[model samples]
Target: MEAPPVIAVVGPTGSGKSDLAVSLALELDGEVINADSMQFYRGMDIGTAKITEAERRGVPHHLLDILDVTEEASVSDFQQQARALIADIHGRGKRAILAGGSGLYVRAALDVLEFPGTDPQIRRRLEAELEAAGPAPLRQRLEAVDPVSAGRLGDARRIIRALEVFELTGRTFSSFMPAREYYQPAVQIGLDVDRELLRERLARRVHAMVDRGLLEEARRLDAAGLRKGRTAPRALGYAQFLKVLDGTASVAEAAEETVVATRQFARRQLTWFRADPRVSWLDWQDPGLVARATGLCRTVPVQPLA
Candidate 1:
């Protein structure tokens, strides 16, 4: 019997990951399984760049809009859901295309990572430290305690998590973290675009979001009390727009800030994906990118054990 195949399309935000995934799904008869952290929320469409039904081009998407914005979703949760979805897709003799820019989420779904079970006391202390000392001090402390894990996780939230694990287990977080062994047979395709072009695209996308009632969406989410320090709330536009809602920033200023923050995020995402040896990179502007990606997908030998 042949083993199942999975395709993963990963890149920085505004790197055309969605479009590529959609096109590939249409071409390959695949369903998109979202790997973005924020796009999992039901009410976070505009800010998370979630694909609407209309935008799916008749291709099915899974693990999107499944959680309320206020609900806390973890990497383990995502991995479990994604693995189930992939199995279902394979059982149906269809393709599963994993797509998004969230590096940790994508990594969790692809690599067999054993997340330490949660500890409320550790979490409470870490949250208190984050509240009182801000992310920098917590990040510095994580770096001091677990430089390897800290270096792997440059994002503030991820750094905090490393510290939380260390605090609870009294061991380096890296010691508990799993290696990057493939969990399934997958064709990992990374989208790469010019930095300047990507920045311009991000700015344009943010402006488009503003025109698409992003402020109203943000207001509704805020009213739901979902704009707190939750992971979803910290997504690119929501946090910046919250400043506008609280009168700390003008709408125009918030929009600009969102663009800047998203650009930085895209940079970080590129760095993360670039560092991964598993992904086969492709130039986003290549006229034959789709053909190349599809060809690579077809040629990847399926691993029975995976």
Candidate 2:
């Protein structure tokens, strides 16, 4: 018998991918495997807009809260762990639902991507460069060597890691990127929304996160060494509010920055998912979204999802 099809719900943040994933899981008798990198860290609840237990509605969620604030979440590690989790879920005769708007993490979990090995010495040297000279110079160096990788790497940690990959392997980091190929038999459902409406929604979502104690959560994580986390520190709300905790910005200012940053992040995510022609697009606000997504999943011969 053929393996069960892996289901992926992907879109920009605030596009309701999480809720859709839950609906898909319920209809398909599936389990959710989180692809959001920020949600990987514990104590990052409010800032990450992590779903509460009640919101989960009894579905088992894997790969969430598996890392402390101090640990860097590695895409390579997630790829290995998530594939194993998906295999286990498949072995149990259940479908695996990959959920999150995090483009790279989602791709890492479901794509035929390869992670280049890291050399400790080279990583240390590149990280030292990032610390002493900051991201500007390192990014400039990455641009000189690998413009494609440099363009995709927005954070200091990723920039440093890409540089390290170049130095250690003598190959451009982009060379390792997977061809538009799936790691398994999978169907990806993408949510579509008006850009202006999405911007409005993202702004409102940031304000709601603040109202829900994102600031207080950031403060707690600060005491718990959030700044030490290379990946977590670069997350949307956490980075903005860390400025608030550092006395560099007011709570309102931080929240506003988070809104703007999140909107830009959403645009990037949409671009990433849209580039793949295989994804079936659905109007996010459709009245029968759940029904439509379910039908797409159950369709045989895998008709293109629109």
Candidate 3:
């Protein structure tokens, strides 16, 4: 009669969290709720490394392929949807496994975090500033207002959002860091790999994606309005390949850039997850990882709904 605890599998992009989530799901009688923002788009499979049906191993996955390339993904919207799905999954007496490398999305799903509302006019104005002046000045403004978020945010889109949050809420975005409390009973399992080894693996993975027609995929999506997509077009592999199609880079150049970018992104993912003391880390290559994670899940204290 007790409610089940939520288990989150989080880590760097290439750390095999999805496979491990499937293993844990099989062991714990759970379904996966994707926390990867990029994987939400239907046609972004190859670039996002979305799991194939065969790879899902019969464990139901949620929140994936639910968006089109044209529609922007909002973490606030996702937070609402994911919490409801977790409640539904729990109501059905199955544990919910939150899986993905996107740190904010993972936190939004399980942590006691609240999203601030956005103002369209303010957003348009900031975006205009970004277009007129580029990201450096906006980043400088963010550094003046919200240095912590400015330090962490590397892209123009996110930098603009942070500034917008400060302007709209009159509070710095980083000041809203979620307390260690969970919205529901939850546990986080983090996966890790050695830096040099992970770099090699990521490079190989990018090459493999190119071999699997990443260029072709990007081209198809491009003709389908990828350029107009505020978010989807800026995703990792998609952005690089867009350069290839633009004649600004070669396919090989794009692949190499993707490898480098993904490696840096993996490091950022590690830093973000490692900051939270609640996450228990395991080596991705551990042979007994599933059993270990199963034990951890069983022992984690279940907090009543908050």
Candidate 4:
């Protein structure tokens, strides 16, 4: 028998992707591999809306809570880990369901993507330049050589990495972007939602998280050196609540800020997934969402293992 195609449940945050993925896993005899970058950190449950053990419904989950809050989240590392899990699941004659909203990480695992090699020396020099001069000068330099990357990237770290790639490979970073072609036979099911409803839902969810002790969680993680981390400290709720930890903001203010940031993040996620024509979008609130997603998974084109 041919192997089952990998199933990816994708969409904006709080769009029911996780629940749908869990249902699909149960229906399709699959295990889930997380693609949500924020969920990878230990003790980040409430802020990240991580699925609880009871919510997992006996389905196996991979790659959650695998990183310390102090470590950087690496897309390349996830690419390797997720691919290996998919292969192992396939070898056991089970389906591999990739679930989450991290667009680049999802693409890194499923698409025909290559991670460019990095040079530490080149990166250090760029970082030094970034420290001496702000990102404006480096941004201008990147714009001259790779305008696409410059326009797409907002943060100094990503900008520095793009410049490092250019210096190391003499090629534009955008040139390495993956085409939509799948690395393996796969199907992506995107959960679509009403924007206004989702925005409200996000706000409510943020408030619920705060009620569930997001501020306390943030305090615990902050004591664990969350502020020292490059990535974890910047996650939506955690970042805002850290202000609460230092007395710079009230819990109410942090909760409001987290809601705004999460809503904005969801918008970006929607924009990212919507750009991929390969994804089969389903109404997030559809009563039969699992059935529809399962049907889509069943029809995935057959291809040999990579």
The model with the greater TM-score, 1 or 3, is 3
Using Cα atoms with residue i matched to residue i, what is each candidate's TM-score against the true structure?
0.91, 0.93, 0.94, 0.97
- What is the clash count of model 3? 0
Global Cα RMSD, each model:
2.3, 3.3, 1.7, 1.1
**lDDT, candidate 2, at 1:** 29
Query: Which ranges of candidate 1 are over 4 A from the true structure?
Result: 129-145, 150-160, 304-306
Q: Candidate 4 residues 1-306, lDDT tens each?
A: 457788999999999888998999999889999999999999999989999999999999999999999999999999999999999998888999999999999999999999998788999999999999989999999999999999999999999999999999999999999568888889999998999999999999999998899988988998999999989998999988888878899988988888888999999999999999999999998888888888999997756655
- Candidate 2 ranges with C-alpha deviation above 4 Å: 133-140, 151-155, 300-306
Candidate with better TM-score, 1 vs 2? 2
Query: Which candidate wins on lDDT?
Result: 4
Looking at model 2, residue 240 earns an lDDT score of 90
Across residues 191-253, which tens digit of lDDT does each residue of candidate 3 receive? 868888888988999999999999999999998898888889889999999999999999989
Question: Which residue pairs in candidate 1 collide?
Answer: none
TM-score of 1: 0.91
How would the candidate models be sorted by lDDT, starting from the highest?
4, 3, 2, 1
- After superposition, candidate 3 runs with Cα above 4 Å error: 303-306
For 91-183, candidate 1 gives per-residue lDDT tens digits of 777788999988888888878777787787878888888889788888788889998887777766677778878877788889865667887
Candidate 4, residue 123: the lDDT equals: 91
